[model samples]
Target: MSININSKLDSQNSFWDINLEGELDVSTADKLKEYLHGLVEQEVVDMKINLSSLEYIDSTGLGVMIGVLKKLRTNDKEIYIINPKSNVKKIFTITGLDKIFKVEG
Candidate 1:
Protein backbone atom coordinates (compact mmCIF):
# COMPACT_ATOMS: atom_id res chain seq x y z
CA MET A 1 0.00 0.00 0.00
CA SER A 2 2.89 2.30 0.79
CA ILE A 3 6.56 2.47 -0.12
CA ASN A 4 9.54 3.10 2.09
CA ILE A 5 12.61 4.73 0.56
CA ASN A 6 15.87 4.87 2.42
CA SER A 7 18.51 6.88 0.60
CA LYS A 8 22.03 7.99 1.33
CA LEU A 9 24.52 9.95 -0.68
CA ASP A 10 28.07 8.79 -1.07
CA SER A 11 29.72 12.12 -1.56
CA GLN A 12 33.09 10.68 -2.42
CA ASN A 13 31.59 8.61 -5.19
CA SER A 14 28.99 11.26 -6.04
CA PHE A 15 26.22 8.76 -6.23
CA TRP A 16 23.12 7.74 -4.32
CA ASP A 17 22.52 4.53 -2.46
CA ILE A 18 18.78 4.04 -2.37
CA ASN A 19 16.83 1.16 -0.96
CA LEU A 20 13.17 0.53 -1.65
CA GLU A 21 10.83 -1.44 0.61
CA GLY A 22 7.11 -2.15 0.37
CA GLU A 23 4.80 -1.72 -2.60
CA LEU A 24 5.50 0.73 -5.38
CA ASP A 25 2.29 1.28 -7.23
CA VAL A 26 0.26 4.28 -8.36
CA SER A 27 -0.24 5.32 -4.78
CA THR A 28 3.46 5.46 -4.04
CA ALA A 29 5.07 6.28 -7.37
CA ASP A 30 4.75 10.03 -7.06
CA LYS A 31 6.65 10.12 -3.83
CA LEU A 32 9.55 8.34 -5.43
CA LYS A 33 9.46 10.57 -8.49
CA GLU A 34 9.55 13.67 -6.33
CA TYR A 35 12.38 12.35 -4.25
CA LEU A 36 14.46 11.36 -7.24
CA HIS A 37 13.74 14.62 -9.01
CA GLY A 38 14.90 16.55 -5.98
CA LEU A 39 18.13 14.65 -6.03
CA VAL A 40 18.58 15.13 -9.74
CA GLU A 41 18.12 18.85 -9.36
CA GLN A 42 20.86 18.97 -6.80
CA GLU A 43 23.29 16.96 -8.90
CA VAL A 44 23.30 14.56 -11.77
CA VAL A 45 24.87 11.47 -10.36
CA ASP A 46 24.38 7.74 -10.77
CA MET A 47 21.79 6.12 -8.50
CA LYS A 48 21.93 2.57 -7.26
CA ILE A 49 18.58 1.25 -6.11
CA ASN A 50 18.28 -1.90 -4.06
CA LEU A 51 14.96 -3.61 -4.47
CA SER A 52 15.48 -6.72 -2.41
CA SER A 53 12.80 -5.72 0.09
CA LEU A 54 10.34 -4.26 -2.37
CA GLU A 55 7.17 -6.33 -2.33
CA TYR A 56 5.56 -5.03 -5.53
CA ILE A 57 5.63 -2.46 -8.29
CA ASP A 58 3.23 -1.30 -10.97
CA SER A 59 3.52 0.53 -14.27
CA THR A 60 3.49 3.90 -12.59
CA GLY A 61 6.47 3.01 -10.48
CA LEU A 62 8.32 1.82 -13.54
CA GLY A 63 7.49 5.06 -15.29
CA VAL A 64 9.07 7.03 -12.49
CA MET A 65 12.26 5.05 -12.89
CA ILE A 66 12.26 5.52 -16.62
CA GLY A 67 11.78 9.22 -16.24
CA VAL A 68 14.68 9.47 -13.86
CA LEU A 69 16.83 7.40 -16.14
CA LYS A 70 16.07 9.67 -19.03
CA LYS A 71 17.04 12.68 -16.99
CA LEU A 72 20.26 11.07 -15.87
CA ARG A 73 21.20 10.02 -19.35
CA THR A 74 21.40 13.61 -20.42
CA ASN A 75 24.42 13.92 -18.15
CA ASP A 76 25.85 10.53 -19.03
CA LYS A 77 24.80 9.19 -15.65
CA GLU A 78 22.72 6.08 -15.02
CA ILE A 79 20.61 4.18 -12.52
CA TYR A 80 21.62 0.75 -11.32
CA ILE A 81 18.99 -1.64 -10.01
CA ILE A 82 20.47 -4.02 -7.50
CA ASN A 83 19.03 -7.21 -6.10
CA PRO A 84 15.49 -6.99 -7.39
CA LYS A 85 13.10 -9.75 -6.41
CA SER A 86 12.42 -12.23 -9.18
CA ASN A 87 8.93 -10.93 -9.82
CA VAL A 88 10.08 -7.38 -10.04
CA LYS A 89 13.00 -8.36 -12.22
CA LYS A 90 10.60 -10.10 -14.54
CA ILE A 91 8.61 -6.93 -14.98
CA PHE A 92 11.72 -5.07 -15.97
CA THR A 93 12.70 -7.79 -18.38
CA ILE A 94 9.23 -7.99 -19.91
CA THR A 95 9.12 -4.24 -20.27
CA GLY A 96 12.57 -4.22 -21.91
CA LEU A 97 13.86 -1.92 -19.18
CA ASP A 98 16.44 -4.36 -18.01
CA LYS A 99 18.43 -3.70 -21.15
CA ILE A 100 18.12 0.01 -20.78
CA PHE A 101 19.18 0.15 -17.16
CA LYS A 102 21.93 -1.76 -15.51
CA VAL A 103 20.46 -4.61 -13.49
CA GLU A 104 23.00 -6.06 -11.12
CA GLY A 105 22.57 -8.95 -8.74
Candidate 2:
Protein backbone atom coordinates (compact mmCIF):
# COMPACT_ATOMS: atom_id res chain seq x y z
CA MET A 1 0.00 0.00 0.00
CA SER A 2 1.05 3.56 -0.65
CA ILE A 3 1.70 6.02 2.14
CA ASN A 4 -0.32 9.17 2.59
CA ILE A 5 1.06 12.22 4.37
CA ASN A 6 -1.26 15.00 5.45
CA SER A 7 0.24 17.99 7.16
CA LYS A 8 -0.31 21.50 8.39
CA LEU A 9 2.22 23.88 9.83
CA ASP A 10 1.72 25.44 13.25
CA SER A 11 3.24 28.88 13.23
CA GLN A 12 3.00 29.30 16.98
CA ASN A 13 5.31 26.36 17.65
CA SER A 14 7.33 26.52 14.43
CA PHE A 15 6.30 22.92 13.95
CA TRP A 16 3.98 20.76 11.93
CA ASP A 17 1.26 18.24 12.63
CA ILE A 18 1.64 15.49 10.06
CA ASN A 19 -0.72 12.57 9.66
CA LEU A 20 0.36 9.31 8.04
CA GLU A 21 -1.87 6.59 6.64
CA GLY A 22 -1.46 3.38 4.64
CA GLU A 23 1.96 1.73 4.48
CA LEU A 24 5.46 3.13 4.76
CA ASP A 25 7.93 1.00 2.87
CA VAL A 26 10.78 1.31 0.38
CA SER A 27 8.30 2.37 -2.22
CA THR A 28 7.03 5.19 -0.06
CA ALA A 29 10.12 6.28 1.81
CA ASP A 30 10.86 9.08 -0.63
CA LYS A 31 7.46 10.56 0.02
CA LEU A 32 8.33 10.87 3.66
CA LYS A 33 11.68 12.39 2.85
CA GLU A 34 10.24 14.86 0.41
CA TYR A 35 7.48 15.93 2.72
CA LEU A 36 9.71 16.40 5.75
CA HIS A 37 12.48 18.07 3.84
CA GLY A 38 10.02 20.41 2.20
CA LEU A 39 8.79 21.43 5.61
CA VAL A 40 12.29 21.97 6.88
CA GLU A 41 13.14 24.11 3.89
CA GLN A 42 10.15 26.25 4.78
CA GLU A 43 11.66 26.72 8.26
CA VAL A 44 9.27 24.36 9.94
CA VAL A 45 11.54 22.35 12.12
CA ASP A 46 9.74 20.28 14.73
CA MET A 47 6.97 17.90 13.72
CA LYS A 48 4.40 15.77 15.43
CA ILE A 49 3.90 12.74 13.23
CA ASN A 50 0.51 11.13 13.68
CA LEU A 51 0.79 7.47 12.83
CA SER A 52 -2.49 6.28 14.27
CA SER A 53 -3.81 5.30 10.85
CA LEU A 54 -0.56 3.92 9.51
CA GLU A 55 -1.07 0.22 8.91
CA TYR A 56 2.50 -0.86 8.15
CA ILE A 57 6.10 0.29 8.01
CA ASP A 58 9.12 -1.48 6.61
CA SER A 59 12.78 -1.17 7.53
CA THR A 60 13.36 1.36 4.79
CA GLY A 61 10.62 3.49 6.21
CA LEU A 62 12.14 3.32 9.66
CA GLY A 63 15.50 4.25 8.23
CA VAL A 64 14.02 7.30 6.55
CA MET A 65 12.53 8.47 9.81
CA ILE A 66 15.86 8.05 11.56
CA GLY A 67 17.63 9.98 8.84
CA VAL A 68 15.14 12.79 9.17
CA LEU A 69 15.57 12.88 12.93
CA LYS A 70 19.33 13.03 12.64
CA LYS A 71 19.07 15.83 10.15
CA LEU A 72 16.68 17.73 12.38
CA ARG A 73 18.97 17.35 15.36
CA THR A 74 21.61 19.26 13.45
CA ASN A 75 19.15 22.15 13.40
CA ASP A 76 18.17 21.70 17.05
CA LYS A 77 14.78 20.42 16.03
CA GLU A 78 12.87 17.16 16.58
CA ILE A 79 10.05 14.91 15.52
CA TYR A 80 7.51 13.34 17.83
CA ILE A 81 5.81 10.13 16.88
CA ILE A 82 2.20 9.88 17.91
CA ASN A 83 -0.32 7.06 18.28
CA PRO A 84 1.38 4.15 16.60
CA LYS A 85 -0.54 0.92 16.20
CA SER A 86 0.49 -2.11 18.29
CA ASN A 87 2.32 -3.96 15.56
CA VAL A 88 4.17 -0.85 14.52
CA LYS A 89 4.90 -0.16 18.16
CA LYS A 90 6.44 -3.60 18.45
CA ILE A 91 8.79 -2.78 15.60
CA PHE A 92 9.91 0.34 17.43
CA THR A 93 10.48 -1.71 20.60
CA ILE A 94 12.39 -4.46 18.84
CA THR A 95 14.51 -1.92 17.08
CA GLY A 96 15.09 -0.02 20.34
CA LEU A 97 14.01 3.15 18.54
CA ASP A 98 11.29 3.93 21.05
CA LYS A 99 14.02 4.80 23.51
CA ILE A 100 15.62 7.15 21.04
CA PHE A 101 12.57 8.95 19.70
CA LYS A 102 9.77 10.75 21.48
CA VAL A 103 6.62 8.66 21.16
CA GLU A 104 3.31 9.80 22.55
CA GLY A 105 0.02 7.94 22.92
Candidate 3:
Protein backbone atom coordinates (compact mmCIF):
# COMPACT_ATOMS: atom_id res chain seq x y z
CA MET A 1 0.00 0.00 0.00
CA SER A 2 2.29 2.76 -1.21
CA ILE A 3 0.92 6.17 -1.85
CA ASN A 4 2.79 8.09 -4.48
CA ILE A 5 3.14 11.82 -4.22
CA ASN A 6 3.93 14.02 -7.20
CA SER A 7 4.91 17.64 -6.83
CA LYS A 8 6.85 20.34 -8.63
CA LEU A 9 8.47 23.74 -8.33
CA ASP A 10 8.97 26.35 -11.05
CA SER A 11 12.07 28.45 -11.35
CA GLN A 12 11.23 31.83 -12.88
CA ASN A 13 8.81 29.96 -15.10
CA SER A 14 11.81 29.31 -17.32
CA PHE A 15 12.95 26.09 -15.71
CA TRP A 16 10.69 23.39 -14.37
CA ASP A 17 12.13 21.25 -11.57
CA ILE A 18 9.70 18.46 -10.92
CA ASN A 19 10.14 16.58 -7.68
CA LEU A 20 8.95 13.04 -7.21
CA GLU A 21 8.33 11.30 -3.93
CA GLY A 22 7.22 7.73 -3.21
CA GLU A 23 6.54 5.19 -5.92
CA LEU A 24 5.91 5.91 -9.60
CA ASP A 25 4.26 2.85 -11.06
CA VAL A 26 1.62 2.17 -13.66
CA SER A 27 -1.02 3.42 -11.29
CA THR A 28 0.65 6.77 -10.74
CA ALA A 29 2.50 7.61 -13.94
CA ASP A 30 -0.49 9.37 -15.44
CA LYS A 31 -0.41 11.90 -12.62
CA LEU A 32 3.03 12.89 -13.78
CA LYS A 33 1.90 13.07 -17.40
CA GLU A 34 -0.94 15.38 -16.58
CA TYR A 35 1.39 17.64 -14.71
CA LEU A 36 3.96 17.83 -17.49
CA HIS A 37 1.91 17.60 -20.68
CA GLY A 38 0.97 21.28 -20.63
CA LEU A 39 4.53 22.59 -20.71
CA VAL A 40 4.63 22.79 -24.50
CA GLU A 41 3.32 26.33 -24.38
CA GLN A 42 5.97 27.61 -22.03
CA GLU A 43 9.04 29.40 -23.35
CA VAL A 44 11.29 27.03 -21.49
CA VAL A 45 14.93 26.34 -22.09
CA ASP A 46 15.67 23.67 -19.51
CA MET A 47 13.51 21.08 -17.83
CA LYS A 48 15.31 19.90 -14.70
CA ILE A 49 13.72 17.24 -12.61
CA ASN A 50 14.89 17.03 -9.01
CA LEU A 51 15.05 13.36 -8.12
CA SER A 52 16.61 13.81 -4.72
CA SER A 53 13.36 13.02 -3.03
CA LEU A 54 12.26 10.36 -5.45
CA GLU A 55 12.00 6.91 -3.88
CA TYR A 56 11.15 4.71 -6.83
CA ILE A 57 10.32 4.68 -10.54
CA ASP A 58 8.85 2.08 -12.87
CA SER A 59 8.84 1.51 -16.61
CA THR A 60 5.62 3.42 -16.88
CA GLY A 61 7.23 6.38 -15.18
CA LEU A 62 10.17 6.15 -17.51
CA GLY A 63 7.72 6.06 -20.39
CA VAL A 64 6.22 9.26 -19.09
CA MET A 65 9.67 10.82 -19.14
CA ILE A 66 10.28 9.69 -22.69
CA GLY A 67 6.99 11.14 -23.81
CA VAL A 68 7.88 14.43 -22.18
CA LEU A 69 11.25 14.37 -23.84
CA LYS A 70 9.66 13.88 -27.23
CA LYS A 71 7.45 16.88 -26.73
CA LEU A 72 10.38 18.98 -25.57
CA ARG A 73 12.59 17.87 -28.44
CA THR A 74 10.14 19.32 -30.91
CA ASN A 75 10.70 22.68 -29.23
CA ASP A 76 14.46 22.17 -28.98
CA LYS A 77 14.26 22.02 -25.22
CA GLU A 78 16.58 20.24 -22.82
CA ILE A 79 15.91 18.05 -19.79
CA TYR A 80 17.93 16.79 -16.81
CA ILE A 81 17.38 14.55 -13.83
CA ILE A 82 18.97 15.66 -10.61
CA ASN A 83 20.09 13.75 -7.53
CA PRO A 84 18.46 10.41 -8.09
CA LYS A 85 18.91 7.90 -5.31
CA SER A 86 21.40 5.05 -5.80
CA ASN A 87 18.75 2.38 -6.24
CA VAL A 88 16.82 4.62 -8.55
CA LYS A 89 19.97 5.42 -10.45
CA LYS A 90 20.43 1.71 -10.98
CA ILE A 91 17.13 1.66 -12.84
CA PHE A 92 18.31 4.44 -15.12
CA THR A 93 21.60 2.67 -15.63
CA ILE A 94 20.09 -0.75 -16.20
CA THR A 95 17.65 0.76 -18.64
CA GLY A 96 20.45 2.80 -20.24
CA LEU A 97 18.55 6.00 -19.82
CA ASP A 98 21.29 7.73 -17.87
CA LYS A 99 23.22 8.19 -21.08
CA ILE A 100 20.25 9.62 -22.89
CA PHE A 101 19.30 12.05 -20.12
CA LYS A 102 21.66 14.37 -18.35
CA VAL A 103 21.60 13.17 -14.75
CA GLU A 104 23.42 15.19 -12.15
CA GLY A 105 23.49 15.82 -8.47
Model 2, 1-105: lDDT tens digits are 698899998888778899999999999999889888888788747989999999998899999889889988998888899999999988999999998789888
Task: Write down the TM-score of every candidate.
Answer: 0.97, 0.95, 0.83
lDDT of 3 by residue, 28-101 (tens): 88877877776545544568887777788889999998998888888787779989999889999999999988
Better of 2 and 3 by lDDT: 2
Per-residue lDDT of model 1, residues 36-82, tens digit only: 99988887899999999998989999999999999999999999999
- Global lDDT of model 1: 0.95
Cα lDDT computed for each candidate against the true fold = 0.95, 0.89, 0.78
Which of the two, 1 or 3, has more TM-score?
Answer: 1
Ranking, lDDT, top scorer first? 1, 2, 3
Positional deviation of 67 in candidate 3, in angstroms?
A: 0.4
Off by over 4 Å in 3: 1-13
Model 1, C-alpha of 89: deviation from truth (Å): 0.4
RMSD of each: 0.7, 1.0, 2.4
